[model samples]
Structure formats: structure tokens, C-alpha cells
Target: MTRTAPHPRTAVVACATYLPSTLRTTAETEERLRVENPTLTLPTGLIRRITGVENVHVAGPEAQASDLAVAAARRALEQSPGEVDLLIFASGSQDLIEPATSHIVSERLGTRCAVFDVKNACNSMLNGMQVADALLAAGQYRRALIVTGEVPSYAVRWRVDSREQFLRSFGGYTMSDGGAAVILEAGEAESPEPSGGRGILGSRFLARSEHWGVGTIPAGGTVNPHSEGGAYFDMDGAALQAAFASVGVGLVAETLASIGYGVDDLDFVALHQVARPYHDRIVEVLGVDPERTLLTVAEHGNLASATLPFQLAEARAAGRVGPGGLVALVGLAAGISLGAMVIRL
Candidate 1:
């Protein structure tokens, strides 16, 4: 006999996000492109605007990873004042490799609850929510804070000599720096209805390890040794395209079925902001309602880990999503990973 999976009880109470103040427009990129590679075909200003980013602070040796978290947390607290019982920092851009960045954020936010970090390429936020939901279900914590801080600008390589390298700068210009903080609380009948009492139902992860090298920043890790070489983000764009085409279809279909619903049941779907053509294909194939899908790539660009919360915030502000809405947050990025989660709001 097969046993049924139980839905977990959880709710998102408040959310806050920060966008860097600096700006980089596509026109600027085109101008630079003309100077660097006169032969390279460039997207028109309107077509390439998402390749523009603005108002960002470059994280550096002296920059504390917790600074972005603290800024977002403060705003989150102000938005919905509370005493959090757990803190989870999700990112692909941690300040360091050793000591967890969560510790610094917890101390700065004055949250004494358990603290940890979750790293999973761009899906880090969704992964954090899954962990937070599990902890809440286990009675390990009553409330949790999920935060994401991005510094893609810090990873850019501006002096490369190859045209291939010039085109790759899309990652930098197409990416933006920002942070987000969200408060999750255990559902209570008296919980004042919560921002919708949206409980996380289930999540699915698809990791295609074989394509791990398709999209990555090769230079600074254990493999290449940053000390001996110049490190910058690199990608086999063709391979990533194939991966998205194949994995996106199955992962999305399975996720919807796992929740006993079709993609049409979703009131809103938030996908990772890659600003690529494949994003449109996935939405069409999944039959996700165009009106319900939030696309931030054209404006905010692709924020590695902060896309989920940023889109959710947009949906909320626009009143496009509300109580009783079924929301799906999906992400696909480096590591050839794809993740989808269904939340009942």
C-alpha cells in the first residue's frame, strides 16, 4: 500500500528586498562593445536592456557579507515587527568559503535562533524555504527568517580580450546586486490570517550533475586555484540551453503532479530570471498563465539567489496575487539544477 504525503503547515508573514543603487544600461554596454569588438552582433537597446544593471555595490575583501543581510532584515523587521526564532541565509555569493555567513547575519539581526546557510546555485532561496518548513514541521522552531544577498557585479571580468569573453559579460550586466528577507511562521488559527497562511506543500529538485560544467565561474575554486589564474564566470551557453529544454519540461510536470494539480492550477509562477529565450519556452510548454507569471529579467536582470523573493514581492505589491493563491517558484541555474515548490497562499 502506498502512503500519502502530508502537507506541511507554514506561512510567510513579511518580505523585504533591496536593489543596488548603481545603474548600467544596455546602451552603455553596446558602446563598450563597439569599442571592444566591432564585429560582434549586439542586441538593440530595447532588446538588451535587461543586460543593463544599476545601483550596485561591489562586495570586496573589506565588505561584510552580513551587511546586505542586515539591511534587508532591518527592513523586514520594520515591515512586520517580530522576534524570529530561526535564521537562514541563502546564497551562491557568500562572502567567504569557511565560516558560515549566517552567523554574522544572526548576530547583526539580533536573532538568537538557530542559524545556517543554504547554497544551491540560484535555487538557494527555495532550498532555504524547504529547510525552514521542515524545521517548523519538526517543532524545531516556530518562526524562521529567510534572507538572500547577491553581489554578481563583484564577479564580473571587464578586461577580457576575447569576443567570446565580451559576450559573456552579459552575466555581469544582466545580473544585479540586491538582498531580501522573509519571515515564516507556524500556522495558527489565530495567526491573524497570515500574509495568506500560505503553507509550503512540497518541493522537487532536479540536479543534472553531468552538465555541471556548462555554467560556472571557473577561476577561483579548488579546481583551478585562484592564486595561479584569473577567475571569471564562464558558460557553455549551448549546453545550458539543452539542459533547460530537457529538464525544465519534466521537472515542472512532475512538480505539479506531486501537488495534485496542473500548472494551470497555479495562480502565479516565479521563475529564475535568466533573461534568455528558454525562459519563454518553459512557460509556454508548462502552460503557465502569462498574466500570472512575473518576469523581472527585463528590468532587474537575473539575480542569482534573490529572484524568488523579488518576484513574490512584486506580485504582492501589484495585488496580482493574494489569499488562496497557489504559487509555484521555479529556478534553474548553474550546477544544472532545477527546483520547484508549491505554496498555498
Candidate 2:
């Protein structure tokens, strides 16, 4: 039997983003790498040419992932201080492995909302959005706050033995520190002012567990308790590229089809800020106009789960997304997962 789709009752009311003050330039990073490996020979502008990232933000030593989340959450709350019935801390970076980070975020925000964490690598925010959409649609909750704080710089290994090691860790240079929060409210509730059908319409998610090892942190988990590679982030670049080339486009197309829309229907698209090449490939595969999407990698690099929300907020501020316009938020995570959410703004 076919099942009916859930009506979208959740709408994003406000969004806020917080980027760290410290900036790490590509030249500085290249210099550091060269100093560590004397024999290394890389083109002067190779990093920028490949990733289009000139600089990235670095969190202060005293800062933790939860701290950033709280900062962004406070800003979002200030914009729409409605009673948040639920809070989801969706981030790849966590303050601790024991207690849920959502609790800490809620405590700092002074909200007694029910809290939890939803992790799906870089797609954590999109996953959280899907969960929030469900709860709000079911009438189980009226408002939900989704927050992500990414401090990936901590996992970057500066010293490498060879070019292979450096290449494997290249993704690290693109890592940035930031936090983002979005306040979602049920659409059935009357708004103080009229919004032209601005809210989440639907979302689709796909996972390819076979390619799970394409991007991973080899240490710190039960599988590798001692960490053969010092718990640094590692990825098989070629494998990841191949996987995306094979299935990424199909996944996006299916997602759009689920909502009875196409790429042309999107007014603005917010894609994960992995790198310039990845972004270009996604735009090409999805047949989306590059001008319609916001590119943040050039300045902010990859903020993981915080990237999409940050881009969305910036696009809104620039008036790229307006009332009744459709916006597509797409993400690809380390689990070899793909997800797309179409929202009417």
C-alpha cells in the first residue's frame, strides 16, 4: 500500500550564524606544510586553484563546540524568542562523547526545551531539520531550534610524512570553525505578520554505507580505540569523487522529483561548502544555475553541518531568497550520505 506524505507544518522563522574571529590564510597553511616537509613541492596557488578557499576561520583555544552553538542560538532566540518546544544539537563536533551536547546548548540558552543530538556527519543540520519537520507536523511540538557548531580544525594533522599523507589530509586545510542556528515553528499557528507560504516543503535522504570509509576519523572510536593515524580526519579522495560522480546527481534528481519540482524551480540553493570542485560538480550534475547558489567555500571553507545554514542566512540577508521563493538545501556527508530539502522562503 502507498503511504501519504506528511504535510509540511514547520517553517524556519529565523537563522543566525557565528564565525570565529581568527583567520587562517592558504599561504600561511602552505608555508606551514612546506616547513614541515622540506622536500614537498606544490604549486604556489594549487590550494586556491583546487579548493577556491583563500582563508578559513579558526576557533580560539578556549572555545568549544557547545560554546559556539550557544552563541548562535542566542542570536536566533533574540530574533524570534518564541517558546522552543524542542532543541536539537546537530553537529559533527562535540564537546564530549558522554552527555548530549543539546543539553548544554539549552542550559546556556536558558530554555527548558526537550533536547537531543542528531548526527549524520556534515548532513547533521539537514537531518535535524527533517526530524524537526516531522515533530512539528505531527503536532507533537510547536517550535524547534536546530543548532550546529563545527570545530574541525582540531582534527587537522599539520605534520605529514609524505605527499600521500598530505594529500589524504588535504581536506583539513579546508576546515573552518563556525556555528549556525535556525528557529523552526509550526505553520498552522497564526503568525503576527503574514508570510507568503514561507516554510519547509519536504526533504529526501540517501545513504551508501559501502562508501563509509571514504571519509572518516580513524581513531577515537570502538573500531580503532588506539587510533593508528592519531584520530585525524582522513578521506580517500579518489573514492569519494568516484562515488559522487556515480550517484550524486541521481540522488538530487530523485529528491527534487519527490517534491514535484525540478532544478529550475529553485530560486536559491545552499550546498555544503566542501570545495570549489565539488560545488561545481554538484551544480553541473543537478543542472542548477551557478548564479542561483551561494558559494561560501572561497571565504569560509568547509564548516560541515554549519555551512548550509550559514549560506542560507547570508543569502537571505542579501535578498537572494524572498517570500514565496523556493530554496534548496543540499548536503553530502562522510557517511557517504546525500540529502536535499526544499523550502519555500
Candidate 3:
């Protein structure tokens, strides 16, 4: 039997995730880095010691971002059989820069639906859903599939020439390669509640683009298109932490408060995870119970745009939240953007 959604307005029908079979442990990753960078004294266990990520998923060398998305999309489609009128490839990773990656995903899925791309660092999936929900509400389409695949492993620096260089690549170590897809159907869902909508209720986002340079994969753009040296990620971990700190938790708190519920009052919350310490700090400051949130980064590493969707799937499997359940999705992306969305599952 096909899994069906109970949401009426821009309701979520199905959500699925795909993790490559290969699991690369932090110890293995450190040894590999040390082996390739003989001149640099890279410390072992520091990755796990600092980030609390025990292992991460690694896609095969032959796998591209599109491949990952396709894998997850297939599962979602199989779970809920229906026509997908629009497809969106939203992620921090891509197979190539020329044609939109959504087209490639559509080709692999054999879907002749309208498609597009939305890339906004780690918040790509959230933004894609935002677009899809709005369009669905406007009657632009009947169903929308939002998919993401992240492959930060490929850009991870193997040849660390110096201690400083290794530090810049540290964030890459906490990243995992995987894919996730979410399906949202447009209709009036049957809800017993007063307002009577099950899908996305409201969303709010705040950004300070000035801090965009704090994190980046400097290649593939017009500025450094031809340089292999510019390919790997270069990030200031301290700066990124501080940037999010300065932005404050007002965005999330306000969003939840606007709906007359504090974060603790909600059944579930999906927060974009990067490192364990950061995750702890976020939940503590937000005053959300640890039991209500998913500490996914430590186990799955940073899934980038696939994170929020992954948490949603986990919640469903655990029976924490389902149809007519209240939930909130929060995102912290590299462009120094913070977003929060309230939803009735």
C-alpha cells in the first residue's frame, strides 16, 4: 500500500533518506590524511574528539551528487506512488556546474515534470520546500519532490601541507555524503484542529550576508574556476560559530512564539547540525529538551542540506511525530542565515 499524507495545504506526503553503505570512521579518516600528508603532523582522533562524530557515510568514487539524490527520490516515490508535477534539486553539492542538477535528477527518475535548482549552502532543502509550498498553495502544481545530496568528502583535503591548512579543512572531516528527498502534495488536508492545515504553517528567515566569506569552497566560480588549489573547503570554524552566536536565537524563538508555543511545547524540532558541541550549545540556549531534538551530526556527520529531512524521517520511524503532529524545522546555513519553519505533520 502507498504511504499517504493527511496534510491538506501543501502537505508532506513522504520523506526518505539514503546513506552510502561505506562508513568511514574518524580514526580511518585521520590515518588516511596523515598518510597522504607526511610532512604535516596531523593529530589522530582530534576529529572525533572535537566534533564527537564517530563515523560518516562516504559515497563511492563513481557516485555523483545527482546519483545520491536519485537514490533517495526513488525510495520516496516508491513509498508514496503519485504524480510529481515539480522536481527541485536543492543541495550544497552538485555533479557539475553547467546544466541545473534538477534536470539530471528528472532524467534519472524519468519524470517530465518542471524542475529547478536551489542552492543556499546547508539550507538548500529548506529553501526548496519553501518554494514548493508557496507554489503548491498558489496552485502551480499538485505534487513537488524536494531532493538533496551532499558530497563534501570529495572536497576534503587529503594533502595537508601545513598545520594551518589542516585546520581549515577540519570542518570537512565532520561532513558526510548522503541524500534525502521529501514529497509535498497540494490539497486541503483533513485536520481536526481549528486552523485546519497540516503542511507548512509559516516560515521565517534572517541573514547577514557580510559573513558569507567565513566559509566557502573557493573553486568552480568565475573567480577561481581553473585552479585545483581552490577546490577544497576553507573555513574559519571559530568565525562560523561566532557568526551564528551573534545572530542570536531570536529568529527561532520568535517563530515558535508567534504560533503561541515555545520550542519545548512542540512535539519535535529539526535543527541543522554540524558538530556535537555546537548542537549542545544550540539546544541549551534555546531551552529545548534534548529528548525532543535529534543529535544527528555526531552519528551521521554534517549531512548539509539533507539534515532536516533526515531528522524528519527519524522522527516518523521513532513514532515521535506523525500526521497532525506539531513540528518545527530550523536551519543555520553558511551564508550566515538562520531559518525556522512551523509545520503540522
Highest lDDT: give the candidate number.
Answer: 3
Tens-digit lDDT track for model 1 on 1-345? 653344446877777887766566656656665666666666667336433332223444455556777788888888778788889999877867767889888877777888889988788888888889888878889989999887776666656667787655556656667788888888643223222235776678878888887777765568876535465667766677787777655777787786577887888998886764656777888788788898677667777888888898889889998877888888877888888887887
Cα RMSD (Å) per model?
4.0, 3.4, 4.6
Show the colliding residue pairs in model 2: none
lDDT of 2 by residue, 1-345 (tens): 654443445788889999999999998889888888888897797888888999999999888999999989988988898789899999999887769999988888888879999999899999999999998878899999999998999989888887888888888888999999999998864332222245876678888889998888777668887667687878878788788677755666676777677888889999986889889888887889999998899998889999999999999889998777788899888878889888886
Off by over 4 Å in 2: 1-8, 189-197, 226-229
Where does the lowest 10-residue lDDT sum fall in candidate 2? 189-198
Q: Which parts of model 1 are misplaced by more than 4 Å? A: 1-8, 33-65, 188-197, 225-227
**Candidate order (lDDT):** 3, 2, 1
Residue 121 displacement (Å), model 3: 0.7
Q: Which scores better on lDDT, 1 or 2? A: 2
Q: lDDT of each prediction vs. the true structure?
A: 0.74, 0.86, 0.88
Clashes of each: 10, 0, 3
Error of 3 at 275 (Å): 0.5
- Over the stretch 169-209, how does candidate 3's per-residue lDDT look in tens digits? 88998799999999999877665443346777778888899
lDDT (Cα) of model 2: 0.86
What is the lDDT for 74 in model 3?
98
